[model samples]
Every structure is written in structure tokens, then in C-alpha cells.
Target: MTEKYRERVCNGYDHVLTIDERLYDVRTDHQHLLIFKNRAFGRVLALDGVIQTTEADEFIYHEMMVHVPVLAHGSVRRVLILGGGDGATLREVLRHRTIQQAILVEIDPSVIDLCRQYLPNHSMGAFDDPRATIVLDDGLHFLQTTHERFDLILTDSTDPDGPAEMLFSRPYYAACKASLAPGGVLVTQNGVAFLQLDEVRSSARHFNALFRDWHFFTAAVPTYAGGIMAFGWASDNPELRQQEATTLQRRFSQTGMTTRYYTPEIHRNAFALPQYILDAIGKTSP
Candidate 1:
């Protein structure tokens, strides 16, 4: 690698292809998106340097996220996605014909611009869809202000810091609940399951306390900071769909998306926590 091949701000990834030395915006071969596949994280959107999704396995993260709570609440039509600049989650969300609208709230225009230029394939034609509304602002603030009710709210923000920290706060959670229409479902990326156990458990505890029905679920995504990722859901009675597998199978594939991940068993197991995770939740007791 020559000096020209390297960048001034190199955020490494596990896999990245150098399209052009001086291209400034070098796009990847498989995804057709420009990224600096950094040595550590494998691929980040080239301009802003936010990891768009990883080479190892982005589907696991995307599929489980868009499906779980969705399948849990089958009547979903309007959806709100907070902080998914990558567009993968939006892509996954759009797969459901049941979804009439998808409002994506991302803080950085640069991230979306970088992703639109780089991670196109990861999200199909998500950005191009007329049904998707992209808003550049703080998600927490949007939730607090928007009285528009949604059937499902998916918060796929960055790690539990920076501009996204408030999304995990109690006030934001309350706002999310208020934004839900009747039996609305709320789900969020609860940080790395293994490394941020406290954050995950605390989030779950808070949700469990606030929502009459809420539970923590986990999925495996190889590219994330941790191999395991956790998400939480809340409703009135904590009643997840009885037949998540069947519903997803008929609805999603009907829309012509044969998903790589998200199965009924996986849906069940994602919520099935180990005793330690349970004890971990208990340890944080007040």
C-alpha cells in the first residue's frame, strides 16, 4: 500500500476493497458503495467514516431487527426508524407490504450521503422509495415532538454514546410510548450484548418497568463491536406474536424477499436469555 492508497482518517474494517487510489470516494465492488474498509471494522461509509454494515454478516443484524417486533405486532403499517443512516434497516422494514410509511430520523446528513454513495446493495432501493421520509435531526427530539402515531418504532442509532445517548434515556422511552398508536411496538438497538451488558440490561429493565409489556431479545451480528446484539420490545401485555415464523414467512416472502436470517426459532431464541443475563438484569436491582 502506497501513501496515495491510504487516507488521512483511516477507520479500519475487516474487509474493504480499494477501488481507486485518488477516487476520494472509492466505491466497493460487491455493495457499490464508497467506503474505507478499515482494518478493524471492515467497512465504514467513506465520507463520514461510520461503519455501514460489516462484511462478515450484516444480514443477521438487519433481518432480526426489522422482523422480531414487527412479527410480534402483526398490524404494523406506519413505521418510525430512528438513527439508521446505513439504510439497511429501512430496506428491511420496507420488505413488509404492510408498512405504508417509514420515517427515518438520522442525525447526520453526511452519514446518509456516504451510505447512499457506498452501501446501496445493503438496503436494496430503500432510499429511492417514495414511502421513506429521511429527516436529519436528533431522534430523541423528534420523538418528543412528533404526535404522529406509528405502529412500530425501530431505533437503530449508533452506540450508546454521542448524539444517540438520549435515545436510551427514560424520557425518550416515554416519548416513544406516547408516539405509539394503541398497540404500537417499540424496539431499539440496545448496544453490544456481551460488552455492554449493563446498558442492555438497564435498557431492558427500564422498558420492562415502563411498558406493561416489554422484553429483551438478542441476535448475532458478526461485524458489530460484539458478536451478540440486543434489542428490546414493548407493548401492552408483552404478548409477542404467537406464530412469528408463519407470519414472517407468508408476509415477507409474499413481498418477494427471501430473507437470509430471522426464523421463528431464532425469534424465540433471541428472547431466550441465559441465567447469567437474567442474573445480570437482577443485579442492577434498585
Candidate 2:
């Protein structure tokens, strides 16, 4: 049997995919979850009618988000990941041998369990890694109480809504800043810059206030429509984002990690924002 599932991921558009079989459908405490098999996207996961990730292109988003900051810092020992219940982010973080510990704070444990059962390819045994510590708690509360310092913090959160809305707020960002080790870096998903310009501006305003250096970068994930999605970058040390191409290339080669979408050259180019994005982040020409 075949069926069609449609999702309104953003304003004025819909993402439709064919479901070869319905694997799991239930309403978790946080949101409705659906797991299905699709020919194009392979295994698919959705929450509250929004596509979370797909097996076909999950690597693109996960690799770019995890590698850019980790490789740039060049000394990331501990990482704090917010809302990455899918474990793709944790999978990428573990690839770096420099990382000593990775703590994943996910509010919903069911998302983790379900994703592990259905979309194991995305995580690929990352949860069982010895260095990983899974904390089933709210991201903000975990930051508020933990005295631990991290060399890198990555917020793999959903859009500004529901429980995740505060993850983009000033207070939560303040908590994140306080939790970072000196010269530590923080990054967040800022939505699609082409359609969600306000998100970019708001993140810039908040991050600018708390951080000595802040900027935006872009990555194209076809699953996330509306042009290229932006990631918010903040670090007390500005030079981290401006590492020379040769330096990045050497570090990437040292890792000996093969990737499908992220390259050292692409890492450098991701920061070369378009003029419109520059204007949106209030970086217009003087």
C-alpha cells in the first residue's frame, strides 16, 4: 500500500512525501511523532506535522553543524548539544577524537528512543559510544544548574515555538554564554535567512549583546526549504571563525573523516554571507 503525507513546514509552502509504509504513529507528551518509510527520503521522522530529518540528506545537516565549530575551535574537548534527540549531532561530535566528552540534553527521551529504533542509520551507534552522556532534561535548566564548562556548545533546537522557544531567548543565551569555557564557541540554527530574516536579526541582536564576536553562516539542506538555512555563530575569540583555509584543510585531513557535503573549502565559504543576509543581520555596508 502507498500513501501521501504533506507538511506545511513554513509559511506559504508545503512539503509532501510518499509513504510506502507507516511504521510508527503516536503522540508523545511533547508532540505528535511519525515514522514512515519513503522511497525518496528513506526512513522519515516528523514531529507535529513538521519534517524533522530524513535518511537521504540527514548527513548534510548533521555534518555541517557539528564539523564547522568543532574543526574551527581545533581544541574542542567537551561539547553540550541542546535538543538533538535524533543523535545525528552527537554522532558527528564523536568523530573528533579531540572531544573527550559529549553531553546531549534532550527534553524528550521518547524522541531519542524512537529515533534510535527507527532511524539508526542517522546515529549509527552513536548513543552507545563510551564518551557520550545522555541527559534527559530541559536544555535551559541543565545549563542553569550545571557548573560544567564546555569548549563548544551547539543548540540543535527546533524553530522558536513550544518548549524550544526559550532556547532562542536572551536569558537562555545568557546561560549558554556563562557555561562556555574561555574562548569557547556557540552555534544555533537561525532558520532560513531568505524567509525568516527576523530570526537572523533577533539572534544577532541577542548574541551581539552577550558575545564579543557573533556572525551568521549558511548551509543548504533541501529538507529545510526556503533557500539556505542560517546558523548563528558566537565566540569570544573572533579568529576562530576566520581560520585560514590551509589551517582548516590540514585539521580536516588530520581527522581522516570522509563526508558527503562538508569540505574545508565549503567551511570557509559558508561565512561569505549574501548581501541580503548581511542586511538582515544588520551588517549593511557602512
Best-matching candidate per TM-score: 2
Off by over 4 Å in 1: 1-34, 38-42, 45-52, 225-227, 241-256, 283-286
Worst-scoring 10-residue span by lDDT in model 1: 2-11
lDDT of 1: 0.71
lDDT of each: 0.71, 0.91
For each candidate, give its TM-score against the true structure.
0.81, 0.97
TM-score of 1: 0.81
**Candidate No. with top lDDT:** 2
Across 26-136, the per-residue lDDT of candidate 2 in tens digits comes to: 988888889999998899988878788999998888888999999899999999999999999999999998889999999988899999999998788989999999999
Q: How large is the C-alpha RMSD of every model relative to the true structure?
A: 5.8, 1.4
Regions of model 2 farther than 4 Å from truth: none
* lDDT comparing candidate 2 with the true structure: 0.91
Residue range 117-146, candidate 1, lDDT tens digits: 655667678988989999987898898788
